[model samples]
Target: MSEVVLITGGSSGIGKSIGELLTTKGFKVYGTSRNPEKYKDSLFPILALDVRDLNTIQQTVKTIIEKENRLDVLINNAGAGITGPIEEIPEAEIKANFETNFFGPINVIKSVLPQMRKQRSGLIINITSIAGYMGLPYRGIYSASKGALELITEAFRMELKDFNIKMTNVAPGDFATNIAAGRYHAPILNDSPYQKPYGNTLKLMDAHVDKGSPPNLMAEAIFNIINSKNPKIHYKVGNFMQRFSIVLKRILPDKLYEKLLINHYKL
Candidate 1:
């Protein structure tokens, strides 16, 4: 039987690109998006799913298990983003981001682990971001959600070691994904008196996302990770600018790093 993989959020952007790549590479790809019908014409199987909905995740896994007999890789790639300063953001909006970005992936991982454990060999890749490691000025809530995911992934790596179930956290920076296309609209923070001057931040952030790297590059990176006989615990990929920033964040003093980001981006 051919190797099989299940990817969440496979309808568009990085997830969609990964699905297509894995299928072309001879892996049987089963993907789930909330609106599967929109991707009806794709060659691989696409199912409707809401990752936060345990029932949806359970049924999706059950159906795949029946068809594939053994699942080889599970990619928890479903995520959304929001941007706003922490104090100015509402509690509900914070929870909303966590629901989609944190809880959603957790639900999928919970559903897949049983099958993965039974097999004693499986790869789980969480599509985290560079934001997970370092928070940015405007995207506090989104960064928090990914930060939560990073913690969970690290814990899983150790806990699942006995079962030989591999878990990897991928942190990519500035990919030209439709991510900004989703916007995630962080509630009405502009209405806050404290956040009034930052009304233009959204436009600035969107401009950066629009001009970032292509989704195919991220997909290819993920493709390589999934195919490796021995998977890694974490991987990072992005454009040269992001790479430099990651390095600078380490070598530069705290005040110097802050000054560089403020002066360079004109924030």
Candidate 2:
């Protein structure tokens, strides 16, 4: 039987691309959306799911298992973005981002584990961000939330080893997606101390996303991972510079790397 796959936040963007490609490859794909009705024309079924809502997460998983009898792969691609100066960002927004980007995926994983363990086989691929590897000036909150997910996946992988289940994190660099449209942006207050710098960073961030690589690259990478016998703990999909930045952080001194980012962002 073909692998049964579930991709959260799959109504559009990277998740949509992954789901579409996998479906064409003969994998049974179900994508999730908060408003499933809006995506009636989606190539794959769009199950109603809200990552921040435990009840919705549980029901969605149950629905899939009831129909498919098994869920062979889970792509935890549901997440939100927030961009603002750390101090200026409201506490509520920060927590909200964590709810969607961090705790949300954890709950979804928990909901699916029982069935996965019963089958003694499964693969969970978390869609994290390249920014998760390090703090970015204006997108600090997004970085922290995704970074937390990355670390937790490392621990989760070890915990799932005994159950014959595999867990991995796939961090993508800027992709041409609608994430920017949905991201929360703190107002660029004319009198606020960070007004000029924050505004400039925001513009640069948008430009990067506009010029980002195709989302299908991520789909191809995930497809390969699903077919592999031993998938790595972490996989990164992006342009050379974006992937190299992670390596540079490892080899460069803290301050030197900070300087490079500062210059890159023109902070």
Candidate 3:
């Protein structure tokens, strides 16, 4: 029997690409979206899901198991981006961003753990961002949310080791996706100190994403990770500069790293 794979935020972007590729490779893929009807013509099955809603997550996973008998992999790709000066961002907006980017995935993970434990084998992949490793000027909230998920994935790896369940955090630098269009922009005051810098930096960030590597690169990385006997705890996917920047942040001095980021974003 083919392995069953579940992917969230699969209506479009990287999630959709991964779903299509996996389906072609013979995996029984089920992709989730807030409104699956919109993707009625998707190559694989698309289920209605809202990661923020625990009831919906539970029901969807239960439906998958009832039909497939097993879920070999769970890909947490559903997330939202919030961009603005950290100090200016509203508390409500920050909470909502975490709701989708961090807690949503956690809810799904918790719901699937029981079945994964019973199977004694499973793979969980969380799609994070390069910003999670290093804070970006205007995208602090987004960085924090994804950073939280990355840390949680690490803890989960250790806790699930005994159950033979594997987890990985895949951080993609940037990809041409609708993420920018859907990103939440925090309200900026005309007199705020960061108004100009925030606007300029945000533009640069969007431009970089416009030129980012295609989603297929990410799909390829995920495909390899799925087939590996033992995948690494973390995988960074993107162009050389983007992936190398992570290493630079690790080896470079704190002040130097800050300077590099400032210059890159023109902040």
Candidate 4:
């Protein structure tokens, strides 16, 4: 029997690309969307799932297991982007951001872990971002949420190793996706002192995303990870400079790394 794979936020973007590619590779792929009916024409099955809702997550996993008899892999690709100056962002928006980006994946992981442990093997991939490694000027909340997920995945790797379950954090620098359309914009007051700089930084960030690598590259990387007998704990997918930034951050002095980010974002 083919391996059963579940991917959240699969109606579009990188999630959709991965689902399509995996289907062609012979995996039984199911992609989740808040509105699954809209993706009825997709190559793979589309299930209604809102990762932030625990009830929905549980129902979706239960449905998958009942029909497929086993789930071999899960891709936590659903995430939200929140951009604004740290001080200007409202507490409510911050909470909502974490609900989607961080806690949403955690809920899904919890829902699937029991079944995965029963099977004695499974792969879990969390789609974090390059910003997770460092705080970006206007996107601090986004960085924090992804950073949390990245660290959680690391801890899960250690905890699940004994169960023969694999966890990998896939950090993509930037990708052309509908994520921009869905991003939450924290309210910035007209008299806010950070307005101009925030605008400049947001514009630069959008441009970087527009020029990001194709989604197919990410799909290929994920496919390889799923097939590998021993996949690495972390995978970075993007252009050379973006991927290199991770290594640079690791070796460069703290002040130097901050300077590099400031210069890159023109902050």
Best by lDDT: 2
RMSD of 2: 0.5
Clashes of 3: 0
In model 4, the runs with Cα more than 4 Å from the true position are none
Candidate order by decreasing lDDT: 2, 3, 4, 1
Q: lDDT tens digits, residues 104-138, model 1?
A: 89888888888889999899999988877666777
Model 3 C-alpha lDDT per residue in residues 139-214, reported as the tens digit of each score: 8889999999999999999999999999999999889999999989876668989888887887887898899888
Give Cα distance to truth, residue 253, candidate 3, Å: 1.1
The TM-score between candidate 4 and the true structure equals 0.98
Predicted structure with the largest TM-score when compared to the true one:
2
Model 3 C-alpha lDDT versus the unseen true structure: 0.93
Which portions of model 2 show Cα errors greater than 4 Å? none
lDDT of 4: 0.92
**What lDDT score is found at residue 57 in candidate 4?**
95
Candidate 1 segments exceeding 4 Å error: 187-197
Better of 2 and 3 by TM-score: 2
The lowest-lDDT stretch of 10 consecutive residues in candidate 3 is 186-195
